[model samples]
Target: MIKTSFISKTVSELKPSGIRRFFDLAANMEGVISLGVGEPDFVTSWSVREAAILSLEQGHTSYTANAGLLELRREIADYMHKSFEVTYNPADEIIVTVGASQAIDIALRATVSPGEEVLIVEPSFVSYAPLVMLAGGIAKTIQTANENEFKLMPQQLEEAITPNTKAIMLCSPNNPTGTQLGKEDLIKLSQIVKKHDLLVISDEIYSELAYDESYTSMAAIEEMRERTIVINGFSKGFAMTGWRLGFVCAPADIASAMLKIHQYTMMCASTMAQYAALEALKNGGSDVEEMRSSYRRRRNYIVKSFNEIGLDCHTPGGAFYAFPSIRLTGLSSEEFAEKLLMEEKVAVVPGNVFGDSGEGHIRCSYATSMDQLQEAVKRIGRFIEKYKVE
Candidate 1:
């Protein structure tokens, strides 16, 4: 029998994400009403799909440049400018990645030295901590509260930063919580980060999906712009998750450094995905509007449904999730989710799937249809009611 060393231990000791565990459970079970996945209900836009097909038919299967196709990079540059008012040269300031997941991984690996600290706010997207650990960096989690609308308060941030801090991740329109960081919150953070001279990794994947207010990226700030790396993708905005296309925009030096790792690890993202993403940039605004409007409808209904269950949910300003506090049930987030699934056959991810700060909440995705939302609420209500009685 072979024994694994510390090299293998790094990967093995990593716990599988809770979202996948619940999903696998739901998959094997029949009659499950799921609000577990945080993806769009909408299909890939017609134009985007057509672009991919055309690329394939035109025999563009061969690899392009290591950075990516120049035209696609230009389209991405233009989209960033027109939509976010953020400018990049596209020639030297951007690198296409295999989804924002790979971008985050590459940025951390390239920038963070082993034994350095990467400050992450939680409950966060599950990938952050694990990825930091894999790169041999310390995953420093600063737990943000629901009372703050899950915003990373300046005090909390100040308390967390150390001399060894290499980077800090700010996920606005955050995963699980659906918390959108407004201008005021970001301005405060920008000031603090500048004082500390810390590198900022702003995950603005849901930049286009904010409901009450538009997103203000940390990189949008003048001083913070130089110190920040922006990660965005086609997944959240364009309903193109499977396409796995994302990009990173940073200062020329940072982009070049990130490109070295990206080139060595993933030569370039998919050729067809690049084509489809270009189409998303060119003509996908209306599709985004449609999905955003639909998600708003679902978000409103589910927030109401959760309130009716006596679970207090903060108003979600962006993304498709509602992170409702399940504290009233006297069950942990995992317990509530499990009992609901076992008894009512409805699947929702427990809040702790994100982090400890999420312990008393459960995350419900409004990315499903309204009819499904209605039925899932009914099942969830019944399950909670039964648990109360029991």
Candidate 2:
């Protein structure tokens, strides 16, 4: 009998993703309307797919360079410059990764050392803290609030920093909260980061979806180009979630270090996906704009509906998510989500899974169809009325 525990304590003690738990439950149920997952509903644009199909037809099936193809890197460079006004050298400052998730993982692994700490802005993505822990760093959180629109405050960031702090991970067009930090917000944070000589891992995955203002890269900030590592990909904006392609851009030294880790760990992103992403950068702008327009419309409708239904939602600046307060039901986030799912057949992620600051809210992905959203809102309103504290 094999009774020995093979799993390391670090991994064994790690909690499973709360987002996936509800998603899996919804998957097993019949007639469920799920707003749990963060994936886009849009199909990969035809031109992007065609490029991959052609690459496969032409028998380009071998592994790419460890840092990805130079051509794709060049296109990515151009896109970064044009879109976000940041410049990266295609030769040494960029690496194409399997997905934005992988890009984030490698970034954390390369930079964080054992017992060192990384500050995470909470009400953010589920992956940040776990990745930091897996990288042998402590994940200290700076919790944002609904009162501040979930934006990380400069004072909050300053208070969270300590002697052991090495870096801060930021997700703008943040997951769950859908908060997008403007240039002024980032500049304020950057001043403190510079003062403390800390590194920044800026995840700009949803940059193309910003509705109210232009998306600003932390790397674009004055004097921040050297310290910021930009993580972005085709998944969110290009509707290419399955393509599994993302990239990282940093200063030459940091990019070189991350590339060594990538060389040993990932080798390269998919060659076919790289070609497809090239097409996405070159020609998929209109497709992205069309999808963004649809999401903006849905965002407007859902936020208004949640407010009218007494959920007290704030309008999110970017990302296709609506994080609404469910405190009126006098239930914890998990209880609210579970009851809503069981009684209403509508699936949402309990916000507390994101971090402690998310306790009173629930995350609903508005990336699904408007009809599903409309129906889900009705079900949620019914569920809320049944349990309203008043």
Candidate 3:
């Protein structure tokens, strides 16, 4: 054998996402009601998809700049300026990646050296910790409680920072939790980050989906802007997940470093996808607003349904998920999920999949339709009422 040990220990320690195994199981099973994945149920808007098709038809199929199409980057800059009041010199301040997922990976890989620490607030999306590890960074998770509405507190963030810290991976309008940070929290964090002279990888993929107030970007903070790399994409808000279009807006220096890594790894995001994303950014406001409204309706529906059926979930003001305390079942989060799946054929992610703080809870994505949401509730309620926890 040609050196099976060639894989580094840093890579070996990582596990694939726990969310996947359960989702694969649900995919194969017949008639399963999965509130499992956080994907948008809707397709990318017709106009956006048409733009991609138009690109292919027009034979604009060649590779774009490793940093991405200049027009798309310019559009992204304008979107930030107009929508979030953040400015970046698109030429060096932005780079388009395969998805926010790729932007995340590249950002971490670029910023983190081996043995450094990256602080993450949990329960967060599954990627942050493993991505940190792959970059030889240690992931230190700071727990956020449901009582605090799953928002990361400044005190908790302060305590988690250490001398070896490289960055804080922040996801607002956060996944699994649907918790969005307000101005006060972001300002507090900005102060702490500035005080410590730390870097911030701000994942704002769900930024446009905020229900209460428009989503806030850390890049909008004057002091934090230079230190922050903003990760967002055309997925959730634009209903364009499979299109694989995401962009990073950061200081030109950081974007330059990230682009170098990206050039060697993946030359560019798909050209057609870039074109489509540009169109979405340029003229897709109504599409985004429509999807956001639909998501809010579903959010309200799930919260009301779960509360009525005894799950004690709050109205998640952002994102498409509801993290409900299944603690009442006396079963741990995983245990509760396992029983629900086996008995009721309803699929929800175990909260602990996000982190230890997620124990005693389960995540149900309300991205499905009103009809399916109603069905999941009935089955789940029946399972909860009849099942015993030991």
Candidates 2 and 3 compared by lDDT, better number:
2
Better of 2 and 3 by TM-score: 2
In the range 1-390, model 3's lDDT, one tens digit per residue, is 767599887776788888997898788888899999889998888888899999999999999999999999899999999989999888899999999999999999989999999999999899999999888899999999988989888989889999999899999888889889988889998999999999999999999899998778998986889999999998889988998889999898888899989999999999999999988987899988888899999898889888887788877778899999887688888778877888789999999989999988899999999899998999998887886454
Which candidate number maximizes TM-score? 2
Full-model lDDT for every candidate: 0.90, 0.94, 0.90
My TM-score estimates for the predictions, one after another, are 0.98, 0.99, 0.97
The local distance difference test score of model 3 is 0.90
Better of 1 and 2 by lDDT: 2
Q: How many steric overlaps does candidate 3 have?
A: 0
Candidate 1 ranges with C-alpha deviation above 4 Å: none
lDDT of 3 at 111: 90
Q: Report residue 222 deviation for candidate 3 (angstroms).
A: 3.0
The prediction achieving the highest lDDT against the true structure is: 2
**lDDT digits (tens) for residues 34-134 of candidate 2:** 99879999999999999999999999899999999999999999999999899899999999999999999999999999999999999878889989999
lDDT of 1 by residue, 213-278 (tens): 877888778677799999999999899998999999998999899999988888999999999988
Candidate 3 residues lying further than 4 Å off, grouped into runs, are 1-4, 388-390
- Candidate 2, superposed: residue stretches over 4 Å from native: 1-4
Superposed Cα deviation of residue 111, candidate 3 (Å): 1.2
